[model samples]
Target: MFKKLLSSIGIGSATVDTKLTKAQYVQGETVEGVVDIRGGNVEQHIDEIYLALVTTYIREIDDKKFEEKAVLARYKVSDSLTIGPNETKTIPFQFALPYDVPVTVGTSRVWLQTGLDIKMALDPQDRDYLAIEPHPLVEAFLEAVRQLGFRLRHVQCEQAPRYWQRRLPFVQEFEFKPVSGPFKGRLDELEAIFFVSEHGVEVILEIDRKARGFAGLLSEALDMDETLVRFTYGPSDVASLPQRLANAIGRHS
Candidate 1:
């Protein structure tokens, strides 16, 4: 009776730890791992074991900005089980990582959260940081941008407009500045948002043209100097990204 009372209050309860097959993964790949549960001083009934892929994003409301955690994807590993005292059980699981998960760049982060649900006792939880890399085609596109002499300046995940938000609540934005290319003197900066999936990559470019004389300055004041361009490319189009991207920017610059 005493043990049961203590367990209910979480003094001596089952614990859960998750082990991933690898520490780094590219977006859209399957993540395989095992949930290891060790029983405590008394038997306990676990209602469910689950895993969540989580990341943080900046959200603004009424001119106030705050950071919030977002769950990208979740999966249930087991339904129900009884763990005996001092017994250990390992449950293996595999789930596809969402392509929209933020890559680990700048202040952006991705982590896997594991939890075990109990009826009365506190839930056992574990967290593991995941290094998420850009997809291959996305990587190639970024390299192409660099080859065009745009230096990556900053990266962040923030709230997206309703029209831009799809499966995820926020979008990751990458900012670049022209350093030594044809656009160096013609443009001010470039901001890019990438939406990646199994089919292809959709890129949104906000080209900020440098303000010039009276008319250009007036347009800047009205926030009209920026042009929004969106395009989609797939694996087959990787080789032509440099020329295509140059044309896309040159048209607006």
Candidate 2:
């Protein structure tokens, strides 16, 4: 009775630990892992086991910025089970990583949160950080930008507009500045947003052009100094990205 009472209040409750097959993964890849549960002083009934892919994003409300954690995906690995005292159990699981999951860059992060649901008791939880690499086409696009002499300035995930929020509530934005090449003196900065799918990646570029003269200053004051360009790229277009991006920027600039 004492053990059950202690366990009910989480004093001697089961603990959970998750072990992933790998610590790093590319977006859209299958993630495989095992959840280990160790029982404590008394037997416990676990209602369910779940894994959640989570990350944080900044959102603004009434001019105040708030950082909120978002669940990118969730997977139920197991159903009901009874864990005996001091007994150990391992539950293996595999889930497809969401393509739109933010790549672990700058202040952005991704992690797997594992939890065991227990009735009338504190649930055991575990968190494991993951290094997420961009998809191949995304890698190619970023490389193309680098080749054009644009250096990565910042990266962040922010709340997306209603129209832009499809699978998740936020979108990851990559900011770049021209350090060399043709765009050095002509452009101010570039912001890129990627919408990735199984077929291709759609990129939205916000081209911020430098104010040139009195007219340019007036245009900037009127918020007319930025241009939005949208395009999509597939696997076959990898080799021509440099030239294509240059042409697009040139046309708008």
After the best TM-score superposition of candidate 1, give how far the Cα of residue 47 lies from its true spot, in angstroms: 0.7
Q: What's the TM for model 2?
A: 0.98
Query: Per-residue lDDT tens digits of candidate 1, residues 106-190?
Result: 9999999999999988888999999999989789988998999999899999999999999888999999999998899889999
Residue 231 of model 1 has an lDDT of: 99
Mark the regions of model 2 whose C-alpha exceeds 4 Å error after superposition.
Answer: none
Clashing pairs in 1: none
Q: Report residue 86 deviation for candidate 2 (angstroms).
A: 0.2
lDDT score for residue 124 of model 1: 86
TM-score of 1: 0.98
Off by over 4 Å in 1: none
> TM-score per candidate, in order?
0.98, 0.98
Residue 30 in model 2: lDDT: 94
lDDT of each: 0.93, 0.94
> On a 0 to 100 scale, what is the lDDT of residue 190 in model 1?
94
Q: What is the C-alpha local distance difference test score of candidate 1?
A: 0.93
